[model samples]
Structure formats: C-alpha cells, structure tokens
Target: MKFTLFSLCRRYPIWVAVLLLYAVASLVSPAMLNPDQVLNIVRVTAFLGMVATGQTIVLLTGGIDLSVAGVVTLVNILSTGLMLGDNGNIFVAMLACVAVAAIVGVTNGVLVAYFRIAPIIATLAMNSILFGVALVYTGGAPHGAAAPAFNTIAQGDILGFPASGVCWLVLSIAVAMLMRKTVFGRWIYAVGANARAAAMMGVPVRLVVVAAYTLSSMLAMCGGLLVTAYIGNPSLGIGNSFMMTSVVAVVVGGTALSGGVGGVVTTIAGALFITELNSFTNIAQASTGAQFVIQGVLIAASVVVYRLLARRPRA
Candidate 1:
C-alpha cells in the first residue's frame, strides 16, 4: 500500500505540492485545520473547479477562453430574471440559460476556428459583447430572485454533502474519465500539440477546437448559475474574478499554457489549492488587492517554473 501510494504520488507530483500547501495553510490558520473547514473548502472549490474544468479543455487545445466571466455573468442575469423566485419556472429558465450559453460558446468557436482570429482576441472581444448584452438586457441594475428550488442546487445539502461539492466531484470524475478514455480527448491533445499535424492526420481539428470552446463556455455557464443560486440575487461583475482565477488554477495545476499537458485532476487540485489559499487570506486579514497580487504572482511563477522544467534535459 505504501508503494502504491508512492507510485500515485510520483504519477501526480502536483498532488504532493497541493498537499504540502494544504498542510502549511492549515498550520498557519488554526480555523482551517478543522473538519468543517474541509467542507467549506470543498464548497468554494466547487464553483471555481467547474470553471477551471472548461478552461482546462480549451487550454488543452492550445487555446484560451477569456470570455468565461462574461458568460457566467450573462447566465446569472438571465436565469435569475427568468426564474423570478418561481420554482415552477426553474426548468424553463435553466434551459433558456443553457441555450444562450451554448450560443455564446458557438460564437467563440466559430470566430477562433473559422475566422482564424487569435483565441485570446476573439474571446476578449466576445467578453465585451456579452457584458454589453447583459447590461442591455438588465437595463443596468439586474433585479430578480432565484427560485428556492434552484437555490437548493447549490446552497443545500445532498446526502449530507454540499450539493455544489457533490456536483464538483461528479464533474471532476466525469471529465477525468473523458480526458483519459475517449477519442475526443485524443483529438484535443493532438490539436493542442499541433493543429496542422492533427488536420494532416484527418482529425477534425476545426470541429474539435470549436467543441472545446463551446464546452468551456457552457461550463462557465454552469458555474454562473450555481453562483446566482448561491448568492440569491443578481450582480454585474459577480464572475469577473473567474476570468483570471480559472486561468490561474489551470496553470497552477501544472498545465502547460502552450497546451497538451493538463487534466481534470490537476485542475481540481489547483482549484482546491486556490480556495484554500483564499481562505487563508481571509483568515490572515489580507487586503483584497493583495489577494489579486498573490494570484498574479502565482500564475507568473507557475509559468516560469513550468517552462524551466520543460527545458530540463531528460534522463
């Protein structure tokens, strides 16, 4: 069992780093050393983890989605407005939200895949468009309440577990399976590693890229909806932090910014680490601006270290 655990650690070195960080944070923040803090960490991690999963997919194809915050904000506005605290309307409202989210994803995909625009530029522009659309739809201040039933999806417990945490676990496991056990996963890796080569080998490179972007946006939508439910109302920039934090989580998880080297496990671990760090910040009474600075530093440090490790001479 010891050897087996050791082998698993060797297979996933980032997990070891995450554990170390967790231990250090726990030691520093006595509050976080308790069992309840574990659940708290999982609950918060769920929201970021969902977004990170989508970002992971896009990054795996050597692409990035800067529009996630927009998608989340838009979805949050639409879902709450449509539900209007009516449980009877939740199904329809959620369906509408998901549809709109998918359309946004498709737009991002088409721009990047068909128009040949840079992913970063395309998604950034889309982010502006989405925010504008949301503002127009809300007439500036969004006003509506999430259905009580809908709130249960994120706010309530499921079999003694936070529903959001359960959702996170399920999504993490499913995405991990998809990445490791599917043909589409192979295509993702291939295209990220080399689009031209993948296309030469008859892979539907454009389709894959589009699918990845679409999936990324939809996942962001899921996070948005859950956040809306959790928060019980509407806000314009609720998801703004997600835009950068998702990227940070993906990078901190050991994924290559250049693509082709990340998975669901890595991303979930990253999300957990980020959430844990944030909790520590709160406990330590760090300024909000300091939190952003810390995250930015983490991203830069991750990239530098990853690039350096990649450059190392192989045995």
Candidate 2:
C-alpha cells in the first residue's frame, strides 16, 4: 500500500501537489471554506481549463501560442463592436469573432511552419501586431455591453452548478477522447515527438501544424467570449494574464515543453490547481507584486522539479 501510494505520487506529482494545496487551504481558512467558494473556483477553472485544453494540444505538438492573449482581446473587441449592445445579433458577432481567430491561427502556422520562423518569435510577433491593432481600434479603452444571449453562457447555471463548469467538462472529455481515439490525434503526437519522422512516415506535417494553431486560437477566442460574459463588459487586456498562466498550467499538468507527452485531462487538473492558488493568494492578501514573484518562481521551480523527477531512476 505504501509503495502503491508513492508510485502514484511520482507518476502524478502535480495532482498530488494540487490535492495538498486544497487540503492546506481548507485547514488554514476554515471560515473561507464553503460550497460557494468551491463552486466559484470550479467555474473559474472551467474558463482557464478551456484555454489550457488548446494549449495542451499545441504544447504536445511542440508549439506554443503566445498570441492567445492578444487573439482573445481582439476577439472581445471585435465581437463587442459587432454586438453593438444587441442580443439578437450575438451569433453574427460570434461568427465574426471565430473568423478573426481562424485568420490569426493560419497566419501563425504559416509563419512557423512555412516560413520556418521560431514558434516563440512567430507568436510573439503576432501578439504585438494584434495588440497594436486592438489598441488602434479600441483607442485603448474598450466599452461595450455584452449581448444577453451570449452573456448567459457564462452567467447561467443549471441544476445549481455553473454553466461554465459544464462546458469545460464536456470540452475536456471530448478533447481527451479526440486525442486518444482519433488518427489525427495520433498524428499530432507523432508530429510533436518528431516532425521529420512523422513526415517521413507520410503524415501531413504542415497541415497538422496549421490545424493545431487554428484549433488553439478558436478555443482561446471561446474563452475570451466567456470572459466578456463573466465580466459583463468588454475590457482591454482582459486576457493578458492567460498566456503565461496557460503555459504554466500545461507544464504543471506534466506536459513536456519538448512536446508529445501530455493530455488535456491532467491539464484540467492543473488549471484547477492554478485557480485555487489564485484564490488562496487572495485570501492571504498577497500583493500584486508578490503574486507575480511567486508565480514566476513557481514556473521555474516546476521546471526544475520536473527535470529532477525525470532524471530519477527506477528499481
């Protein structure tokens, strides 16, 4: 029994840490521990979990989408502008939003896959471009009332649970199954594990890379839309924090930065851990500066710990 538990911890160190954090939080803040807080954390996790889902796929393909933050902001600005405070036109605005994400995704893929630009550089450039466009379009201050129908996707709850949680669960299961059960999914892992080998084996490497980026951008856009709904307004830089957080969540979920070794299921758990961490900091009254420092240290520490664990030999 002892060895079985130890093996489980080694195999899923991130999950062990998450459970430990929750246990500590419950003990430290007994008054703050309640059903409502747990439910709120679940809802918030759903939002980040969706973003993490896409990031997981991209990371598994050995790519990262730094422009998710910018794409999300631009989606909000464009959708809000189109909605024009009208719920009836929400679908039209959503279509426009999706189209924009598709365009950005293709551009990122082309720059990285076709032009042979580095993933970091390509996505970073895209982020700057998108950020500039959003600033120019919104004049740096975005203000628009979200459509009621669209807003309900984030706000409405069914059976006493948040709608976002349900959405996240459905997406999580679908994406996990997609990656596990489909040929294309296998192709993604193969490409990530070794793009050259995957192509040599007759896999459509470039097409798969493009699709990965496109899917990631679309999910980020979806998360952005939900953010707008949750906040009930369009806000500039609303997604500014998600880019790094998503990457960290992916890493903490035990997804390799080198790619081809992680899944959305663990990524969801990582997202929940992060959400709880954020809440814990709030409860502890940590300053913004302290939080940033702590977060940075966390990424660095996670990398180090992962490497150490990976180096450990088994009997």
The candidate maximizing lDDT is: 1
Q: lDDT for every model?
A: 0.87, 0.86
Clashes of 2: 0
**TM-score for all models, in order of appearance:** 0.94, 0.94
RMSD score of candidate 2 (Å): 1.8
List, residue by residue over 5-84, the lDDT tens digit for candidate 1: 55554556567767877787778877777887888788778888999999999999999999999988998899889989
What is candidate 1's TM-score against the reference? Answer: 0.94
Clashing residue pairs for model 2: none
| Clash tally, candidates in order | 0, 0
lDDT value, residue 307 of candidate 1: 69
lDDT of each residue in 1-315, candidate 2, tens digit only:
356877777778888888888888888886447989888888888778888888888899999999989987888788888887898889898898889999999999888789989888999899889889989988987767788877777888869899888888888789899899999899999999999999999999999889888888888888888787787677777879888998989888888989888888889888988888889888888998888897778777877877888898853
